[model samples]
Target: MEEVRVKLPFNLAAGETEYRSGVWQGLVLKWQKEHLLLELPAEADSISSAVYGGGMGRLKRAVNQFVSRDYECSNPVRDMEAKLVEWGYPLEGCAGLMTAVPLEHAAVAEEDTGSAGIFCCVTAAAGNAARAGSQRSVLAAYRPGTINIMLAIDGWLSPSAMVNAVMTATEAKAAALADLGISDAENGLPATGTTTDAVVLAVSGSRRYAAEHVYAGTATDLGGAIGRLVYSTVTASLRSVKAAEAERK
Candidate 1:
């Protein structure tokens, strides 16, 4: 069977892929393969489950770049640190996520309300998809297939609100997988997400917006937008992979 390349919704440049929204700028850098880079308008408050910098922090003191790299190495933390040095991005200021999925299959969705704008990017590979509670305990190892998400919002959010946003986004991801009938290969149950799924949520923390979001639940406007964007982007990314696989058959 011939290999079929999946087409992205947007164009990819020869050396670097660039995308811009009202709030942020993104570039898909070409190293040995491709990785995603997001440049913020200013230092933003972020929360993530990334391998390199996986925690709640403020992207301050020249720390403003967020990256999602495609990695298959056993030593993700070390390899990721070395890659940052090689790429001339400081480890201090950058938050990173790793995945086995190729960046060419990445999907992006954006929504701009007059008050707040949201941009979401996702790279997903679900071969090891699993429900959260269905899997048995095992030693930790680097899993190749995973779903990685990066979301940037051009508005102010409290710290609690940022965490709320993560919860909302996660629910949307599970909903996307369930809606697509993606089952856990191990348990034969509906997959909530992959074993190694990670997400990063960043907010501008700008005071320009009249309302400071203290809550982001499904009932709130911000949470509703986050859910919709994540759901659509995850669905689109997986569908692209499925389409490519079908072509190979």
Candidate 2:
């Protein structure tokens, strides 16, 4: 049940448009047997320079401040799953641990108003299933007021299974800020990257049954798309497990 963290780098040396086109790489978490592991890719690379103005400006600063020289990051879904598979770990659902921190202003009065980081984290957990396979459960975690809306959904529903549902929920929240005519990438935070845009991070956990398995998930798409795939995979696996269990009964 131990957690192992590994820093991953891209094969920029292998490709021509490595840095310019962006490559996938990141930090990984694995268990004792090394069978299951989770990957956490920094959100710094998820910036869409075109869609969100000032995204690149924020991205550059974030990379320099939070990421290492070798860090080749790209969103955090597929990369996370890839890291697990590469390590030979089975897929699981979300872990149900989501939190958001608000942003703040450093120059304001000392006692008047501090900032909340304004962040959200989703956790997915996977474990052995009935047919000697693995199953996952996903949970969405967000900030107050808005977070409850996401949690109001069925408790047993995996965040992966309801990808659109989750994104719709998040976009709805972001829309409010957008309506305020605020740029998603540069609000007013003192943080390294674009202070305006909100940061949403999702994490998946893989647990190895024994101590001899290898770690494999990789962070590929940091966009909302991968979230759909993760959910689809888990939902399919769960169905297969249920069918097998029924046969055994």
Q: Which ten-residue region of model 1 has the weakest summed lDDT?
A: 60-69
Error of 1 at 61 (Å): 12
Model 2 TM-score (2 dp):
0.22
Query: Which candidate leads the pack in lDDT?
Result: 1
lDDT for model 2, please.
0.23
Q: Per-residue lDDT tens digits of candidate 1, residues 1-249?
A: 122122354444554355556434432222233456766666778888877777988652121122343435577778777777877776775776777675667787776655577888887868878888775554377644378888888888889999999999999999999999999887799999988788878788776668789998899888988888888888888888788789999
What tens digits encode model 2's per-residue C-alpha lDDT throughout 112-198? 001101112121111211111122232242111111111111011123433433454344333323333323222232111111123
> Among all windows of ten consecutive residues in candidate 2, which has the lowest summed lDDT?
104-113
Runs in model 2 with CA error above 4 Å?
1-23, 29-36, 41-165, 168-200, 203-224
Q: Quote the lDDT for 61 in model 2.
A: 14
